[model samples]
Target: MADEHRNEHAAPHHITPLTTYIFVFVARAAGTLLTWFASTVDLGWMNTPIALVIATTKAALVILTWVVVIGSFVWLGVLFVLTFADYLTRFWAIY
Candidate 1:
């Protein structure tokens, strides 16, 4: 039965081209530089959202490049949960 199942299903294979890897690396580096530059600018209320957008884009790129699509979604779900938890606990004035 095991042999039959193995024969029925082919092994998973993924081959990313070198250029794709190089592009991802460059994009990540650019995202880092952009994040740093955003910190220097005084956008006041816009700063946090801008930073979050940049960070999310970088994370999505990494997740999609290195992991399966489903894995990316799972990771994003976990991040959302963590962010929500942090938001919920922020106003805790338990003195």
Candidate 2:
């Protein structure tokens, strides 16, 4: 009875495989479309920033929909570490 109770309280991995496939397909499609649209515009210096923002948004949506909130948090942590590395390198270059 105790085991059953514990199992019931566990985080449910209820997302079906087909749901994951759909999410990946949708994200890829949206990302590609955004890239194509952005290319047609003359944002110039803002192009890279716009593309990165769009890509990150698509990635986050896919991650949240398919892998859930926990996976999104883990990805955010990785992004933070990479950002910190960039900051450290910039600071060290002053020497």
Candidate 3:
């Protein structure tokens, strides 16, 4: 009876296949290389946007692979708010 109860309350184990891990690893490595390459190229006004997109993509991959989806979204929401707040304040010196 105790064993049965323990099993019932235990969280299910999710086993990520080796191929999934390998795929993520390769993707992250590619992202790293892209970032390095991006730094060397001067794209004028487009540089920051391009780098941000690549970085965000890399971050999303890691979050999706290792974090619970809902939790990651919540965290991302908080970060977005904080970043927006900082951006909004950046122009304060001009005022």
TM-scores, in order shown?
0.72, 0.55, 0.74
lDDT of 3 at 88: 75
Please, what are the lDDT tens digits per residue for candidate 1 over residues 1-95? Answer: 65655754677778989998999999989999999999999999999999999998998887878888796688888999999999888877864
Model 3: per-residue lDDT, tens digit, 1-95?
A: 65655767678889888998899999989998999999999999989999999998988887888788897789889999999999977878776
Off by over 4 Å in 1: 1-9, 75-91
Candidate 2: which pairs clash?
A: none
Q: Whole-model Cα lDDT per candidate?
A: 0.89, 0.81, 0.88
Candidates 2 and 3 compared: the better one by lDDT is: 3
Best-first order by lDDT: 1, 3, 2
Top candidate, metric TM-score? 3
* Candidate 2 segments exceeding 4 Å error: 1-12, 17-20, 86-89, 92-95
Q: Which window of 10 residues has the lowest lDDT sum in candidate 3?
A: 1-10
Which ten-residue region of model 1 has the weakest summed lDDT? Answer: 1-10
lDDT of 2 by residue, 15-37 (tens): 46786788778878979898999
Ranking by TM-score: 3, 1, 2
Task: Count clashes in each candidate, considering only residues at least 3 apart in sequence or on different chains.
Answer: 0, 0, 0
TM-score of 1: 0.72
